[model samples]
Target: MNRTDLGPQRIVCLTEETTEWLYLLGQQHRIVGISGYTVRPPQARHEKPKVSAFLSAKIDKILALQPDHVFGFSDLQADIAAALVRAGVAVTVFNQRSVDDIVAVLWQVAALVGCTQAAQRWIEAVHAQHAAMRQAVQQRVQRGARRPRVYFEEWDDPPITAIRWVSELIDIAGGEDIFPERACQPLAKDRVLADPLEVVRRAPDIIVGSWCGKKFRPERVAARPGWQDIPAVRQGHLFEVKSADILQPGPAALTDGVAQLHRIVLAWMDGQVAAVLGQGGVAQAGGCHA
Candidate 1:
């Protein structure tokens, strides 16, 4: 088939990221169904039929929609994608685990929807934003501003740490993910911080919680045994970045989520500069150097 002819006219997004992207690309009409967890645009929940959850889907319901294509994410949705493919439905599963992967998948999605030009424009714009952000942070680093150690908790029970994309975004936003080493682990089991005190040992300057679709209770996190000495807990540096913004692995992560992370990190770095200056240290907190 011609590449243009391969594009889907009716689509189902089994994940929030794709649904949110289509909406941003001005192609939401192509999506006949979306995941129940979609809330980025808000209108998607009311406009599209909810047909899937993160790890499960209503196969019959999806078939009834007669979508020409179905979009899903990660190995977690492998079974769902396999079932749909077995049923002779066209399915594309994107396992984007890193910042670059997210950008690559986004461009591929745009091609699938025949909106490559529009998506490319947005991509180029965000890439410029990335350049500007990197420049700003690099300057701060040269000025000896501390890149706050951040513990981004994806899940609180066993305490899953940052994902690859989130970890990269944190660095871009002027914070260092304390567990960057574990960010690329594909499974949550592999990323789990087995010992709760490990987080305390790291002595993170900030504790960011997303909790994967649940409310992040900073108090609950602070109340954990022996966490009082943790710098983040002691100084009230707890924060919540909504899962919808950071966990989606798409536009929201590249834009809104990143912006939020940057604001938090920059403020902390500025405070470090101020504290150092107050103690008669020579590094000032402004200019291209900060």
Candidate 2:
């Protein structure tokens, strides 16, 4: 189908990533609705009517829009997808679980919107950046340097580790995630450290918190009992990465989030080396507290 004649003319995106991706690919004209939580591109939240939220939607309002296609993600959005399907509205739900899955979904969405060439170009550019970053990380790893043990907290109520894509980026950035094996789990509770004290046990060299949609409070994290004993806290290695930058299942995660992870890890690793060599006091790694 030609871009002008693509099947979907009026689309509702139930997630931020897809909405942002569509806009980036110059297909925003087709979008009629978006999630209320979308803030990546900013203008989307202002221009498009919000018909849905993360795991809920106003079915009547969405149906009223008469969208030709509705885009959603994961089992979290399964109910919304079912409701639209029952209403005889076409919907495509992407259940991407990893970084690679996210990239594939980008291509698939572009194809669905008849913007395959645009998607390819965008993908190539991201891939080039990823390649360069990966090489730089590998070089740092090969220089007889110890990879920092990173603890990525996705939530604090029960303490959750990083998701698959975040974990992958940590590895690519030359750091080993504390809960590397649990990276693929979807729910935060599943990745939670049952003991809460396990974080102390792991002795992570760096701590990065995203805290989903809320602003991360380093002081709160540092005040946890026994947490002060952890190397990351004692050495001031705690950092906050915003959810939009690292947790989004889209190009922003791969580009902005991964790059942030790389920079943080690199700085941490460099600090450790510098301290061991008696060059100066421990290096302080910076983070976006937003």
Candidate 3:
């Protein structure tokens, strides 16, 4: 088949997920422009002209690229999409909030470019990986491993909690999200902890911070007033998951992000068991004395 005969021969990806997906689909040739924030398939930055950031774009530069189609994410990009649409450029803005939505968007993008079968195979592989992780968690629970309470910080200043997909991943990774109710809110503002002390009250056993592009500072978190008493703080159970890994709301989140979460949970469980044994208690296979 002639390459141009497929839909959207020349495309612009305004987000990392679509760009990463196209690359994984062996359709990178179609991408003429990409987001500056793209780091997943790092070579995309060197190979494609960066025409957009997360919330802003160089409209004239994007137009110069003459992309037949532009892919973006979320209502946050509405203005950019509108500008491009007014200029006679086709745009698709996907708002995928959960793991299922991410998978669906992956299929939609693939099918649009005549790669449905390829996408199907990739989706199957993703499902298998997810299943393996779930099985591991189930076995751990069956062995009487206590699931730790996890508090995932998306932003530090206002202390926003995990999104829906992240909370779901934590559950699948053998940890309970402390602010699961906040995860249900799609908007970051809606998930904001009006009082940061609420996190102290929640007393998460593990704290994972991915402060959206900024490095996570454990000391700063530990120093928060009254936070010292939290189990995670007292036990030094704080960790960092990079924004690019867990905050992307795409394949990266499903794969690398979830894997990291699982590792963190498993390590914590092992530590709990060791703590019990060190205290002269018999280490029970199905339960931790600590």
* Per-prediction backbone clash count: 0, 0, 2
Q: Tell me how many residue pairs clash in candidate 3.
A: 2
Which candidate, 1 or 3, would have the higher lDDT against the true structure? 3
Q: Which candidate has the top score in lDDT?
A: 3
Instruction: Return the clash pairs for model 1, or none.
Output: none
Best by TM-score: 3
What global local distance difference test value does model 2 have?
0.80
TM-score of 2: 0.90
Alpha-carbon lDDT, every model: 0.81, 0.80, 0.82
**Candidate order (lDDT):** 3, 1, 2
In candidate 3, position 197 carries an lDDT of 90
Residue pairs with clashing backbones, model 3: 143-286, 144-286
RMSD of 3: 7.8
Q: Which 10-residue span in candidate 1 carries the lowest summed lDDT?
A: 281-290
* Candidate order (TM-score): 3, 2, 1
Candidate 2 lDDT, tens digit per residue, 80-157? 899999999999998776878989999999998898888988899888888887777677768876788999997888
Model 3: per-residue Cα lDDT over 1-290, one tens digit each: 22324799999999888888999888999999998888878898899998887879999999999989999888889999999999999999999888888899998888888888888888898889878877887777798878899999988888889999899889878899999888888998899888989988999998988887777778999999999999989988888777787788777788888888888887777665333222211111110000
Off by over 4 Å in 2: 1-4, 272-290
